[model samples]
Target: MNAIMVMELKKHVQDRGLLFWMLILPIIFTVLFIAMFTANTDDATRQQVILSIVPGYVVMFVFFIMISMVSAFIKDRDKGMTTRVASTPISPYFYLLGKWIPFMCIVIIQVIVLFLFGRLVYDVPLGQPIILLILSIFLTFTVTGVGLALAVIVRTENMGIAITQIVALGGAMLSGLWVPLEMMPDFMQAISRFLPQYWAHQAFQDAMAGNIVFTELMQTLLILFGIGIAGFVIAILRYPFFLKRAVH
Candidate 1:
């Protein structure tokens, strides 16, 4: 299983397009965001803005990462790679974990890059960036799991691409990516609570606020865990439909 995962990581790195989005795109957006936002805001206002914006950045990065993961799965299916894997002794869970390795590395790199850029250039204080890193990783577990399930559930690559963008954009908007929850319309704020992105943003926000409430924190963590587990369950149950042979 470990060998299979390593081979999957190697294959992903060799795929230039996938590697570019996973490694380059997020950093580009994050840098551009800092450039645009920093040009005019006062230092005091900047700190508060950072408090709000960091969570959004985390969410955006995760969204892109999920898209990359789902796209890779689609590519594997097209190339008959998944069928070959299915013939092996590997369980679906092991196959899934192996597939996730590259995205996990990309997510870790994104978090580290954001921390350095935020601290060095923007003067955003992250007391201990490690906490933020851990939260980002946990959130990826949920996002990647959901992405895999989508790959299994969708019939065509083109359809999966459309669904990927919709899910990412919807989650981002609902999680207050374009605007802060406190300032958004009341109904929107109410709707955001039902999305995984909201729970993820909440976890990051609480870590940044420096005053952690155990109940709030636990609730958010549980929600993310449930989402991840649920996605995995659906994928396993619907393997016949998701697997190419089932369609034939």
Candidate 2:
């Protein structure tokens, strides 16, 4: 497992495509979107918009990890790497730990980079540092879980591409990342609640606002944990079948 994780982490560092999605794309979008929205607004309004959208954008783009996750799994299978791993005596749990942990580490770095960018570039008032850190960690767990689940569930590169579009694009739109939830219709708002992105975004927004009520924090934390746990459970249940298919 340690070997598998080290291998994945090294690959992640060298993958220019992964860097583009994880860092470059998010940075470009953040600057463009923040500039576009802050235009013509008063100082207070601009600050408010910056606070809202910058973190929302962070939440939005971190999900692009899903594409990389699916691709990694499929690439390994197609290249016979999965077969090699399966032939070893490693437990499936250790194998998955190797995969999931590296991504979580990647996400933590991604979140910090984006947060620092927002702080220096946009003057985003990160009200509570501890809350932000907690939110980042929990959100990464949720996202990594979803990514791992998709990796096992999607069978081919083509399908992974299609589903990545649906998940990365669709999740952002439905989760109120594209626009504030209050501006949407009541029904759309209701639907947004069901998305993990929505909950994570809400937690981020709350943390930014310093709205750190105990019950509210607990509720948001619970939802994030629940989503992550559910995703991991699905992945674990399906992993055996995935291995069999890959080996065959």
Candidate 3:
């Protein structure tokens, strides 16, 4: 399992296109948002805006990992790698865990980098470091689980990538990543409750302000993992059908 996880991480590291989308572009986007959030000269509002939005970028970019995962599954199926993997003695659970855990770690690292970048470049602070860390862990699991399920759901690489964009962008918009929930219509804000992004963003906001409450944090964790559990169940339910098709 460790070997498989390392190989998957190495594969990601070697893919320049994946690197561009997953790493480079996110950092650039964060930098751009830093400028926009800094436009207001008022110190308090500036910090609040930075705290509110920087975490959104972290969650948004982590969402793009779904595309890479879906692409990997499709490409492997096309190239006969999935067939070979299926024939191996390893259990499907181990194989999926090997893939999923690495991406979770990757997203954690990415989120940390983004937060540190915010701190260094913009003097932004996350008042409770542990709270942010906990949120990152839950958020990573939620996103990685979705990525795994998506890998088997799409029939084609193009479809996978297209869906990734729609979900990532649409979820962010609806969940108040691009705009504050208070600024949106009542109906739109109500809709945000269904998205894991909204909870993750709220958790991060609480962490940033050192306002962490155990009940709220636990609630956020539960909602995030609930989404993850649903995704994993869906992936398992469909894996046999997808594997049969891939091997043939």
Candidate 4:
């Protein structure tokens, strides 16, 4: 498992497309939207807009990691890597963990990098660093768990890519990442409550404003955990079928 994870990490680091999607494109979106929205606002409103947009974009782009996750799994299966691994003495659980952990680590680093960029470049206030760190960790879990499930479920890389975009972009819109919940219709605001993205973005905003309440924070963390665990359960259950369909 450790060897698999290390090799995967090396591949991910060398993948320029992953770097661009995880880091570069997000920063570009953050800057572009920040400029567009803050252009006509006063200093106070501009700061408010920056506060909202920074975390919004962060949460949205983090889901893009799913694209890479899906691609990796599909490529491995097609190249007979899954068959080779299965023929080894390694446990399937270890194999799954080996594949999953690298993506999770990448997400954790991605979150830290994007947040630091916001802090250093945009001067976006990040209140309560400890709380923010905890939130980021769980957010990584939630996203990657779902990615794992998708990776095993999708038959083709393009299918996974299409679904990932729908989940990431559609979830962002419904979750108020692209706009505040208050600005949306009543039905949309109510529906946002069901999305992991909504809890994540809301908790992040509260943390940034230094408005952390213990109960609310726990609730958000638990919700994210529950969703992630569900995803993992699904992936584990479906993994046998995934292996059976492997090209080798």
Best by TM-score: 4
Winner on lDDT between 3 and 4 is 4
Best first by lDDT, ranked: 4, 2, 3, 1
Which regions of candidate 1 are displaced past 4 Å? Answer: 128-130, 244-247
Looking at model 2, residue 48 earns an lDDT score of 78
User: Which candidate should be chosen as best, given lDDT against the real structure?
Assistant: 4
lDDT of each: 0.71, 0.87, 0.85, 0.93
Tens digits of per-residue lDDT, candidate 4, 1-248, equal: 99899989999989999999999999999999999999988999999889889999999999999999999999999999999899999888888889999999999999999999999988887888899999999999999999999999999999999999999999999999998889999999999999999999999989988898999999999999999888889899999999999943
lDDT of 1 by residue, 1-248 (tens): 79767787787668787656654665576667656765788987767677667667767666666566666777777778788878889888777767766666766666666656666765666654565666767777677778767867776777777887887888788778757788888898999999988887777777776655668767877787788778778777766555655323
| lDDT tens readout by residue for model 3, 80-154 | 877888888877778778878878877888788888887887777789998889889889889989889999889
Candidate 2 whole-model C-alpha lDDT, 0 to 1: 0.87
Candidate 3 yields a Cα-based lDDT of 0.85
Q: Which tens-of-lDDT digit does each residue in 1-248 have in candidate 2?
A: 89999999999989999889899999999999888998998999888788878888888888888888888888888888888998899988899889989999989899999999999998787787898899899899988898888899988977877877787678888888888888989988998988878887887878877886778777878888888888899989989989998889
In order of appearance, the predictions have TM-scores of 0.87, 0.97, 0.95, 0.98
Cα displacement (angstroms), candidate 1, residue 111, comes to: 2.7
Candidate 4 ranges with C-alpha deviation above 4 Å? none
Over the full model, what C-alpha lDDT does candidate 1 score relative to the true structure? 0.71
Rank the models by TM-score, top first.
4, 2, 3, 1
